[model samples]
Target: MTNAVTFKILEDIARDLSSDEITFPTFLDITFQVRSALKDPNLSVEQLAKLVGAEPLMSAKIIRMSNSVALNPSGREIADVKSAIVRVGMEAVRTVSFAVAMEQLLKSKQMQPFENLSQRLWEHTSHVAALCRVLARKLAKINGDEAMFSGLVHDLGVFYLMSRAANFPELVNDKAELHALLVGWHDNIGHALLSALGSPESVLEAVRDHETDREISTVSNLSDVLYVANKIANRSSCWRDPELDGAVDTSVLDTLFDAETLAEIIDESEEEVQSLKAALGG
Candidate 1:
């Protein structure tokens, strides 16, 4: 395809998003409701269960996650949505719901042509999210659950670009060219989508700054956690190209975390990472 064709795909993506012509999955609608309900301190367990149970797929996801090795130490399975909600807590439920929503979005017919690439990207995001959870708990002194949420959706722009590219057969047929196109525009598209989706300021900020080289920023913020976690996850990801190892940066580890502490965190995170990846359908 010519440069004109490539540019048209980019323009369509922008226009579709701006005009709200892109139809995201219905589960996202349900997820937003559950997320909003979880924020109310006064929301009762019964009310919370009702909110979650209204969506059967999400309820199953919550219950299944509640019974995972990471969350359920007793080996007992949760048979009901309410019990699952109580066992996993509000934040975790929100995380799992979002994961389910994204999974549903990835399976849409529009993404059929790029299923392989989409699934690969989801795995990469899941790894970053798992590492972000560990980093926040071990170093950032922030909410680990929120950190994972931020990591999970960090590549919303890339996924959006991929989905948009599906409409243009020329783009999907050329992997290298598609990669270059996505890398060039995902950050901006991701920022806009997050804002329109009503993401928290901290989450939006972290996603916006995650790709920037803020090597000089001294504040131990979520962006730093995301950056370090993203790099570490990239290094270990299955989708990572072996030839790109030299391009990976390790200098930030010393600046963002103590060597001994970082080691311990990674050591402790292996099991949790596998458990979370499995839960998210990675």
Candidate 2:
């Protein structure tokens, strides 16, 4: 794609977002429904289970997630959606809904042309999400589940941009142009798309700032946890190619945890990270 075409696409996307006309694929219907239902404070576990049951695949995935070692350290198991919802809590259910939706979106026919990129994106997302959960609990003393959810949705803008880019064969065929476009616009586009999806302000903030490098004495908040997790994941990120994109700067990590402590944290949490990734369909 030429400079003119790229600029035109960016301009069009900006106008659409400013007007609150963000486009989402049809597969997101279930996610929207689940999120809308989750907003009802009075909704009981049974009610939510009934709604989840309407989608058999998602219900099964939730059950599997509830049974995953990351969520269920106990050897106990749950067989049904209601029990799964009770075990994982509503926030986790929301995360699962998005996980399922993203997996489905990646497998869709329209996205087949970019299958490799989509798979890499999902792998990066899963790695960051699991790291966020572990770092939040072990270092930040915050809600690990919430941190994981934030990590999972942090790259939502990239997904949205890819979905739109599929319509332009010229742009889609040029990897360099496509990568540059996604890098330049994903953060703001993700924030807008999350806002349109009625995401929480805290989550929106984390998504918006995950890529910004900053000095930190501690991983104290959700944003801090996400930012650190993203940096760690970038070591094995889909967006990074050492030969092409150059080496990643990991100096800030030293300020957060000494070499040994950080290594220990990652080593101890390796199993949990892989378990959570599997649970989320990585």
Cα lDDT over the full model 1: 0.76
| lDDT for 261 (candidate 1) | 67
What lDDT is reached at residue 59 by model 2?
Answer: 93
Q: Write the per-residue lDDT of candidate 2 for residues 1-282, one digit (tens) a residue.
A: 356667887887778777846555576778889888988989999899998999987898899889888889997999989999999887888888888888888898889989888988899898888899998998889888889999999998888788778888888788777877887789888888788888889889999998787898988899999999888888767554454456767678888789998889889989988988988983
Error of 1 at 239 (Å): 4.5
User: What is the alpha-carbon lDDT for the whole of candidate 2?
Assistant: 0.85
Q: What is the C-alpha lDDT of each candidate?
A: 0.76, 0.85
Q: Compared with the true structure, what per-residue lDDT tens digits does model 1 show for residues 70-167?
A: 77879998889999888987777778777877788788897887777777778888888878887787777898888988888888788777766777
Error of 1 at 110 (Å): 3.3
Worst 10 residues of 2 by lDDT: 236-245
Clashes of each: 0, 0
Worst 10 residues of 1 by lDDT: 238-247
Per lDDT, the best of the predicted structures is 2
